[model samples]
Target: MIREQLEKADAIEARIQEKKQDGAGPEELEMLRIEKARMLRPLTHPNANERVYLARRIDRPHLKDFIPNLFTDFLEMKGDHLYGDDHAILGGIAFFHGRAVSVVGHCKGHSAEENLACCFGMPRPEGYRKALRIMEEAEKFQRPILTFIDTPGAYPGKDAEEHGQGEAIARNLAAMSRLTVPVISIVTGEGNSGGALAIGVANRILMLEYAVYSVLSPEGFASILWKDASRAPEAAGKMHLTAEDLVEAGVVDEIVPEPLGGAQEDPGRLYASLDKAIQEALCSFDGMMPEEIRAQRWEKFRRIGNGE
Candidate 1:
């Protein structure tokens, strides 16, 4: 039914465009607008499955898309001091609202070739280490840190484990917790497992309205709990992984509203809202001492799942 509504809305929009090209007048255009809205009424309140589908859309805005829109003077940094660079995770120094800040994010590609290059946005041990390196630099400079999380999890391959993936993630968690500068994390898409949390310890955590952050994917949870991945929709309901759920549970500080039909459908509006939210969040910590910032983060994490 949702698909049908979307298709109908698309068809109406196509007609409206065609009419405009053929010199349709104001009355005709206004009628078409009303019809389009009526056709899309059912989709105004999407269900869990629809939200998950929107969140995981390959065409949805990624870190690369957000960086150019939200920040300026981006100077990309690469590599962990101990090993080679990992393409899956991108980090750098960027100016947000003319203030120098460090940015890091999981970068999933839009095409098959790009995905292969980015290892499907799965970071290896070196990737976590690289993020830690950039974050430490941010701390040293007293620049606020911004992280965009969108990964299923860290790389679970033998090579990653052999190279100390667990240790790298653990180190990031410890380091980020005590970083002297403010850290803000936004879940732009899938925020799964330790991979997400490794870069996620922050003073302010925000999630896109359609985005999800959880210990594991709904399909993975379903497979483990019921031995059937096909029951993912059911699992999503039970897990309370949606942005609204997280906000209500105090796991997320704010929920940035997405554009109509999700962020993929209208990126410009999404970027504008996200940029404003980030600026406000960063400003909220203004003039606070480093210890106060660190203590706030510490208390924030400790309160999660404790109903605080």
Candidate 2:
């Protein structure tokens, strides 16, 4: 069902783009972009696998897309000090409604060549370290931290292991747990394993309605437990990795809804919704003492899945 919707949506989007490039009338283009887009529909109750596909759709907005739309004055920071910069994870300073903030997230580029350059958003140790660097700076300036998560996992290559991937991830977890400022993480797409979690620990965790957050990808889970990747769909069902599941489990604070046919089809609407979500989250931390903020974050995590 979703596959068909995606195909239809793609065709409509391509048509709109082609018409624009060919100097179509504004009314005609708007009719196609809006009215024709209305033809694309969403499942009333999509299965977990269907949602997973939506989350991984090539047209879905990524961190690179979200940053420019959601924030202002973004000054990108790079390098881990220990090694060269990793494009898989990008971070830096930005302003949210004029308030200084440190922003970071996995960067899964839009094109095949770009994704190859970004290692498909799988970060190495240095990438995590770079994220930590920007975050620690935020800690010093007493600015709120905002991280966007969308990675399958950290790089599993021998080179990443050699550079202490586990330790780097651990360091982030420990440091984030102790941060005095507000830490908000939004899982805009696939959030799997430690790559996602390294930047995910926060006072508030938000996920897109179609996003999936999990310990690992279903394929990996099936490969490890059943010794067959063919059971990935079954694994995904059992894993309960959808935004709805995570919110019910208290693993996510809120779900930022996407427009029908997903964020790619209506990016402006997604950004508008997300902008409000971020504002509410930031406002919730207003007037909170640094210790109070850290304590609230710790208490939030402590109660997750323990049935507070």
Query: Against the hidden reference, what TM-scores do the models get?
Result: 0.92, 0.95
What is the per-residue lDDT of model 1 for residues 113-222, given as tens digits with 9 covering 90 to 100?
98899998899999999999999999888999999999989999999999999999999999998887999999998899999999999999999998989999899999
Candidates in order have lDDT scores of 0.91, 0.91
In model 1, the Cα lDDT at residue 198 comes to: 93
Model 2: what TM-score? 0.95
Best by TM-score: 2
lDDT value for candidate 1? 0.91
Model 2 C-alpha lDDT per residue in residues 9-28, reported as the tens digit of each score: 68887898899899999999
What C-alpha lDDT, on a 0 to 100 scale, does residue 132 get in candidate 2?
94
